[model samples]
Target: MSWSEACHLDRSLLSLEHFFSIPPDYAQTLTGGLTNRCWKIVTTDNKSFVWRPATHITKAFSISRFQEYQILSAIESSHLSPTAIHINDQGLLVDWIEGESLTDSLSFDSLLQTMIKIHDLDTQRLPLAPFNYTARVDHYWMLLSDEHKVPAFAEIYNRWRTAPNLADVGLSLCHFDLAGYNMVKTEQGNKVIDWEYAALADPRLDLTLSIDVMDEKPLEAVYRYCQLRGIEGVDDWVEGVLAWKPRATMMAMLWYLLAYQLWGDEQYLTQAEKLQQAFCS
Candidate 1:
């Protein structure tokens, strides 16, 4: 079923009455979600919160609302994320920071700073699950139709699947999706919104995606990141990110391809083709 259909069905299957302490004055569908459904809720007292509806497809996207809740709880004191309020098998609710999304005006340095704070949080005992890179990639690949599965796709997949993960680098709390759409500029400061893809993993993965999305030079971005994080061996870090670039690109390519297959959106197809050609060329 399409996302809209699932959401419509969920509306009938799920109720919002008991989830809240007091009845909300208003609730509306919040856009920008590609796969999941979220609602912006305003209580009688004028408090605003974001409610992410729980769905069965969480497994499909490798998302765990439970994990997200834990991570948010762990980092709540850091003030870099929204405060987690209530969570259950039904859905999740959190305070919605009032601000504009970092869509058109992305501040790369600001994002990096907030991200470093998250990385600096001691999560060694958080019990959050590690992001299994190979498993996630394979899941997306498996979702694609055979017609969309080009030979180069498998070849690239195998190469990256067998390659060694950066074992030398320590794992930290990484927001796998740091795109502008997931960031917001609140009155206090920048706050990252989505934690569906958050995990304990190689910090370089976040850095890799950050640099790619920011369209900044890889080496320069790594240098800046190292400088801010007080991480030495800039050249080595650069090398690690570069080595992981193709793997990251492959994962993005497969995601777009699968998204196109599921939704039949031309934009996803265009992006998938672009990513494919970049590395396949």
Candidate 2:
């Protein structure tokens, strides 16, 4: 069914032509969106678009639609992502790239190249900050069942709180969430979506996250980042990332559990349970 048929798009401003110029005739919810409600829109001209509507904040850490648009506008044409055309009360509208996320075999060099592009982009329109690992962890941890608490919490918290977290790491735009969900491999090349969590921070944190999610050796990424940027004395920085790993785990655990709570999806619940066990062990 068309966008008009599936839902009540009662305003002319919300019409397909208003956004895409071509009338879109079909709309279906896309799978694996995980964070927001995304719909695949097929236009009468045969072009495809993604329609994502606003949802309430799921976790307490950080995600701002307005910030996403600002950063995106800065780098929209850098070929790192799809083109952004418009933003309405409904949500932002951008050209939808057809591709798969870079999950495995995320070549070190390729990943570094992408990171370089992001770090090099002119970002005068935005303000960014260091990764608030502690706040995010605390927020997510509060969502978990008390009985499932990790025994190492106090030990981990005290040491992590005092350690150097690279808070002063040079500020630059970073796609903070480098997990596969934000990546897509199209015929055009690799592209990252979901700008809601992008911010300015230590580019190294992006590197550390890339290592964590891609299941690659941390030293490999740290070494490459150092080589590319001509930096040194990252031992403390690397240690900061390692210290924050448990919180990363907690973030995942809470996301999955919350997914289960909201959608009653058993897969998410199962994954949450597994992560809880892993963290406590």
Candidate 3:
């Protein structure tokens, strides 16, 4: 039987049926990021939720789906995200939150506050993966070594690598790819979706990774993050996040390339070029 067919038979996997007391009649694919195949599953009675299955997209930074499921299972009570009703090796079922995604001014204070809540979660209960930017950049560069644009990306990153960093780093739960669209502002508050790239790292590092989708500078957010948390060494935090900007930019370019390669769309290639020139020159 196909996966969907098996989903209908397995009571544990078909929690949506149990949750709503109705069987799912159809699942509609939701469009956005190229990393995962997502669906909005609606039951016969109109109850709905998201069913996202992990994909095997190589030449991109490796993502541990198992870790993602673990974090989601742990944070259901935290309310930083939609409650994960069920999770299996295939994926998880979470209520489809209804709200507008944050827009206009790119600096989302609510998103930052939600991030603070996430960072404050006890590390002992929720484990996270190590995030090393240099090593990750080198790995992606190696994967796309033949691509000329990425080499230019690597060269600029080499220059940024010389900057001094803090001797001590504050580690916390980090959503490495915090694209603005990944955040959904519901009645409950700002809930960050997508934990595929979530890990344990310098919270500042996570801030840098998020700048890809933001037009604002890191200084304001960095200062606010420090002030709210009573954190010292404000300049070091800003500098550290700034240093990771190029690496983040490079990772976006790599995703664009992969999108182009997979979909055969010229727009992806064009976007990759625009982002590459913005940083490399």
User: How many residue pairs clash in each candidate at the backbone level?
Assistant: 0, 2, 0
Candidate 1 Cα lDDT to native: 0.79
Lowest-sum lDDT 10-residue window in model 2? 154-163
Question: Per-residue lDDT for 1-281 in model 1, tens only?
Answer: 33234346557214555665666666677789886778877777888888876675566676778888988998888788899988877777888888989987887787788789888889866887677888888888887788887787777777776435454777889998786888888888888898888898888888898888888899888888999989877776887888778888988888888778767899999998899789757
By lDDT rank, best first, the candidates go: 1, 3, 2
Q: What tens digits encode model 3's per-residue C-alpha lDDT throughout 1-281?
A: 33377465443345445455555766766788567666777766777788766444522547665677778878778887766766655566777878777644335565667678888887777766567766765555555535544556556556554323655566788877665678887787777787777887788777776654665567887888778777888888887877767667766776676667666789988997888788746
TM-score of model 1 (CA atoms)? 0.90
Which sections of candidate 1 miss by over 4 Å? Answer: 1-15, 163-167
The residue pairs that clash in candidate 2, if any, are 100-185, 128-200
* lDDT agreement of model 3 with the native: 0.68
What are the lDDT scores of the predictions, listed in order? Answer: 0.79, 0.65, 0.68
lDDT of 2: 0.65
TM-score for every candidate vs. truth? 0.90, 0.78, 0.80
Q: Report lDDT (Cα) of residue 169, candidate 1.
A: 76
